[model samples]
Target: MGNDKKSELEQWLEALCSDPFSSILDETVFRVDVFETETEYIVESELINCTKEQIFVTCENDALIIQVHENENINKQRVVHLPFPLLNKNIRAYFTSPILEIHISKEISANHPNRYMITIHEIDL
Candidate 1:
């Protein structure tokens, strides 16, 4: 692509057709990392300028959903899909400033999916 500027029509079209978060965020601002260990799954997310109270996390079915609610209209959401199913119990989440880490125990999930909210605790680094 060239350095040419997009026309007004193109800009408007892009704005209208963009995804929910694409128009309001740079995507790179909220980076998410997901990995698996022998016994557990780990999800680390970069949530800058966010308060622990404003962040909501939930493990449902095969995905862990991370959401940062800046306000009613502006919010950031990311979903980390687990390689294998996980049970909500034995999950530990520690948040220190811009980094949020979630350690989820690997368990054979139930046939009926369950959704559980994860409480984030602040830890002194």
Candidate 2:
């Protein structure tokens, strides 16, 4: 199939580098996709070889910071800035193996902390 004809999952998989080892040695932490709908913004991050327990997410001001760790020694961090100011309560996240999906609502759920850890729900996919 042509590039435009590919499914989202297929495109996502293909978007991942064919050489997986180089991702670790290279500066890029992981591949990320951010898109918006009428209701919310979706943040999808490809967290390769990482477990739900190894990932940490925090909402700080206008940015969502993702921290990943394979162990005490190996750590990687990525900061995703929001298109608009959002509260922590408006954010929800799920972890399914190599993909961590975060959904941010356009409307505020409630006033929460300026900096707080977001609960990561493990969903079978």
> What is the C-alpha local distance difference test score of each model?
0.72, 0.77
Query: Which sections of candidate 1 miss by over 4 Å?
Result: 1-29, 72-74, 107-113
Worst 10 residues of 2 by lDDT: 9-18
Index of the highest-TM-score prediction: 2
lDDT of 1: 0.72
What digit string (tens of lDDT, one per residue) describes model 2 on residues 50-102? 88889998898878888897656548887766545666448899998888999
- How would you encode candidate 1's per-residue C-alpha lDDT over 26-113 as one tens digit per residue? 3654776555578876778889998888888888876788888876544878776554555544777989999999987666433334
Angstrom error at residue 47, model 1: 0.5
Clashing pairs in 1: none
Error of 2 at 8 (Å): 25
Local error of candidate 1 at 94, Å? 0.9
